[model samples]
Target: MRNLCMKVNYDGTEYDGFQTQPNGNTIQDYLESAICSLTGERLKITGSGRTDAGVHAYGQVFNFHTESPIPIERWCLALNAWLPRDIIVTDAREVPLTFHARRMAKRKTYRYSINANRFPDIFHRRTQAHHPTKLDVQAMEQGLAHLIGTFDYTSFASRRSQKTNHVRTIYEAYMTVDHSFSRPGSDDQGIIHTYITGSGFLQHMVRIIMGTLLEVGEGKKSADDIPFILEAKNRSKAGPTAVGHALTLWSVEYEENIKKH
Candidate 1:
């Protein structure tokens, strides 16, 4: 058997999530269906990680083992023909049989977008979270700075998470301003982009963090409160979970040797 990896991009507005569920509407379910149609094999595909319902992805990666003689380069083209339009396989390649997408992932980056305009942008309604009031971006930046080190993130994780260990390393966390859609002379500053890279994340971790940061931006919380919240180790101490529509699994990275033939 040969292991083939593919990079997928999807608009997750209408699906349940990435994982296959008993209810049968998910990105993985559609992918497996397409694979069965194209290669005539019923097999499982392993994703790098899961993105919650309504959370989109720009560079999600997955791998599956197949015995089909189809060339590697044709995988993307063939899969696209069977997959839905909202979901597309952008690239594909053959890897060593031992390459496991989830196990080999070294880092994952997620982006959360906020529409900080005075009025909602209809074009981005499905992809961005809307916040009408002005936000203090500098304060939000200060709040995010405290999340850059390894620590127990229980305060930012969902109480529903089953993981016993909440410790995770965050290599980088920051925010940027995007003015691509800003009007010429309006007070609108455009979108607020929050980019975070980490070893791994807990369920609803990024969204909870973004929620707290938004509180800081709105003066409901101070930037210095982040450390105290981390020490509290209580989910109630942090802010509410932000909407999933604004979040996206931006990219996943693996060690160079893992990608080598």
Candidate 2:
């Protein structure tokens, strides 16, 4: 058997999530179906990680073992023909049989977008979280700065998570504002983009962190409160989970030696 890795991009608005479900409406389900149709074998594909319902991905990666003789370069083209328009296989490559997509992931970056205008942008309704109130960007930045370190993030994770350890190393966390997409002469301030890169993330961790920062921006919580929340280790200590539609799995990183197409 040979292991083949592929990079996938999808708009998650219409699916349950990334993982396969009994209902058979998921990104993984479509991918596996496409593969089975082309290769005539039922194969299970392993994703880097699960993205929650309505959370999109730009560079999600997955791998599967197959005995088909199909050339590696044609996988992208063949898969896209069978997959839905919203989901596309962008790149494909052959990898060592030992390469496991989830286990080999070194870092994952997620981006959360917010529309802080009085009126939501019609074009970005499905892609951005709409928050009408004015936000203190500087305060939000200060709060995010406190998350850049190894810590037990139980406070930000969902109680539903079955993972025993909540400790994860956050290598970078920051935010940026962009007005290039703003309408001419409109009073729109801009879209706020929050990015976080880490070794791994617990279920709903990024969304909860974004919600807490939103509270800081609204002066409901002080930037200094982040440390206290981190130490509390209680789920109730953190802010509400932000909407999933605004969050996107930006990219996944692995060692330099991993071949890419």
Candidate 3:
């Protein structure tokens, strides 16, 4: 059997998530079924990240081992044929037999989008989280600065989450907007996109951080008080997490050597 690494993009609106669940339809289930249908070989696929329902991905990574003789190009066409319309196999390729998609991943980038308008737009409503209050980038950036180094993030993580270690080092976190109003259908509705890219993330880590920043923007929480929240070791200290619909796994990066022959 040969191991293969695939770069897939999916709209998570219709699926449960990336991993295969007992009964729910998932991205993995469709990919694996497509592979089986084309190659007549049942292979279980593993993904780099397990996003929540309604969460989307542009460059999510997954790996599978199979003895199928289907060409890499045909893999994409064949998989897309049987898979649902929302989930598409953008790229398929052969990789080292030992390459494990989840374990070998070095870093991942996630983008959470928000519509700052009081009235939500009908067209992009599915992807952007709608919030009435104007989110100040300057204030939010201030709170984001507080999340910069390694610290005990117990306050920034979900209380019921199964993760033990609450400490995580954030390489970088920034909030920016695409101000190009020249594009068609560009009302310049103000899309607030938070980009958080790091070596690793704890459960709901990015969402927690986004909530904390939102608090600062709302004036309910002071940017200067961010340090105190981190020390509180209580999840309640942080603001409410943004919905999964706005979160998207942008990409995964890893060492070329780890790609397994």
Candidate 4:
């Protein structure tokens, strides 16, 4: 069997998540079923990581082994033809037999979006988290600055995380405001985007970090309190977990060697 690597993009609104679960309406389940239908092989696909429910993906990667005689380039066309409209196989190619999507990943980037309007927009409701209050962006930036280094992020992790090692490095963490108007020159709304890139993330790490920064923005928590929160190593010391709908798996990066054949 030859290993095939694929880049997947999906709108996670209707599905449970990326991984296959007994509930059965997941991205992986659809992809695997499509592959099985096309190639007549019952193979399991390994994704780079699990994306929470309602979390979209722009460039998620996965791999599976199949003995199908179909060429690599045809895999994309073949799979997309069989898969659901929301889940698309953007690219596919052959990979080394030893390649593993999750273990070989170098970094992952996630973005959480917030709508700063008092009244939520009906069109963008599914993707953007509606926070009606005006937030102090500068204070939020101050709190984010403290997260850009290696630390034991137990405080930022969720209770759902089962990992014993909480140490993870944050390469980048920042928030930006998108000045988009409903009409020309109408400053009715602005989109707040929170981007985080790291070696890896614990369950709900990015969302919790965004929530903590929101607390700082609201004067509920001070930027200087970040290090203390980190020192606490307790989940309760952190802010509430942000809404999952606003979070998206923006991208995943693999090492150079892994990308090379």
Candidate 5:
């Protein structure tokens, strides 16, 4: 059997999530079924990580073992021919047998986008979260800048997560306004993109951080309170959990040698 790795892109609006569930309406469910139907061999695919429902991915990675005779370069075309339009396999290559997508990843990048205009943009309703209010962006940036180091992120983690250790190292965290995405005449006025790259993330960690920053921007939470909140290690000390739709797994990065293609 050949161990194959693939980069996938998907719109997570209609599906349950990345992982398979009992109902079998997820990105993985479709990928596995399509591969089976195409190769006549049932196999399992392992993803770099799980993305919550309504979240999207621009550069998600996955690996699977297959005995099919298909060429590595053709996997993308074959899979796209069989899978739904919302999900597409962008690249594929063979990797060492020991490679495990999630375990071997060096870093992961997630971006949370907010539409803070006076009126919602109808075109981006599914991908961007609508927060139609004035925001103190400078205060939000102050809060986010404090999160760019190793610390116990328990305060920003969700109670629903089962991970015991909430400590993780954040490599980079910043915010920027995206002016490229726009309608025909109207410019992208209030599109805010908050980016966070880390070694790993706990469940709903990005969304929770976005929520905390939103509160800071709204003057509900002071920027100076961030350090105290991190030290508290209590989930209640954080702000509300933002909606999942605004979050996107932007990319997954691995060591140079690990990427065969």
Candidate 6:
């Protein structure tokens, strides 16, 4: 059996999530089914991370061991041919026998979008969350600058989660305005596009961070409060986590020696 890694993109609006559940639609089930049908082997596929329902992805990854001798190109071609419209296998390549997709990843990148305008755009409605009022851009920048570096992310996680260690290093995080997405009868005046890349993310981490930063941009929270929230180690200290629909796993960085084509 050969371990093959694949990069995938999915519009998570229709499916339940990445992990498989009884009677629920998931990415893993689809990939396994497609691969099984194509290769005649029912393989267990493991993803790099689990994304919540309604979350989207531009470059989510997974790996599975199969006995079939199909080339890497056929993995993408055959899977795309059989997979549903909401999901697509973008790329595939062979990897070392012991390389695990989730374990070997060096860093992960996530992008969040917020439409901070009154009018809603049809194309962006499914991807970007909406905010009623205009945000203070300067204050938003201050929060972003303050957020740069390694710190505990306990405040930006769900209280129901069990992970005790909240410390996570954030290499880079910043937000920008996206003026290109325009819909009929809607004005794209101040739509915000926020992208954050890091070693890894805690459960619901990006959304909570986005919510806290939004509060800071509205002048409700001070930028200096970020450090205090981190120190508090309380989930309730941060703002409410945003919805899953606006978050996307943009990409994942693999070890330098991993085969890439």
Q: Kindly give the stretch of ten consecutive residues in candidate 5 with the minimal lDDT sum.
A: 180-189
1-261, model 3: which lDDT tens digit per residue?
Answer: 788788888999888888888986888888888888888888788899788778899889999988877677777777889888888878778887878888888878898887776567688788888776656678888888888888888888777778778776777788877544224564443778888877777778888888878788888898988999999988898888878888898888879765422
87-165: candidate 1 lDDT, tens digit per residue: 9999898888999999899899999999998778888888899997878999999999998999999999999999999
Please give each candidate's TM-score.
Answer: 0.97, 0.97, 0.91, 0.94, 0.95, 0.93
- Model 6 clash pairs are none
Q: Give the higher-lDDT candidate: 3 or 5.
A: 5
Candidate 5's residue-wise lDDT over 1-261, tens digit each?
A: 899999998999999999999998999999999999889988889999999988999999999998998988888998999999999999898999998999999899998989877567778788889877778889999999999999999998889889988999999999888655545464345789898999999988999899999999999999999999999999999999999998889999888987622
Which 10-residue span in candidate 4 carries the lowest summed lDDT? Answer: 180-189
Error of 2 at 222 (Å): 0.8
Where is model 5 more than 4 Å wrong at Cα? Answer: 180-189
Q: Candidate 3, overall lDDT?
A: 0.81
Model 6: residue 170 alpha-carbon error in angstroms: 0.5
lDDT of 5 at 119: 62
- Point out the worst 10-residue segment of candidate 6 by lDDT: 180-189
lDDT of candidate model 6 versus the reference: 0.83
lDDT of 2 by residue, 1-261 (tens): 899999999999999989998998999999999998898889899999999999999999999999999998899999999999999999998999999999999999999999987678888888899987878999999999999999999999999999999999999989989887667787776899999999999999999999999999999999999999999999998899999999999999888898332
| Segments in model 6 whose C-alpha atoms lie over 4 Å from true places | 181-189, 259-261
Q: What is the lDDT of candidate 4?
A: 0.88
lDDT of 4 by residue, 1-261 (tens): 899889998989999999988989999999999999998998899999999888899889999988998988899989999999999988897889999999998889898988876668788788889887767888888999999999999999998789999999989988878766344554444778888999999999998999998899889999999999999999999999998888888888888866622
Model 6 Cα lDDT, one tens digit per residue, 139-221 = 87777777678888778878766777877888888878866654546544477888898888888999899888888878889
RMSD of each: 1.6, 1.3, 2.9, 2.0, 2.2, 2.3
Pick by TM-score: 2 or 6, better one: 2
What TM-score, to 2 decimals, does candidate 1 have?
Answer: 0.97
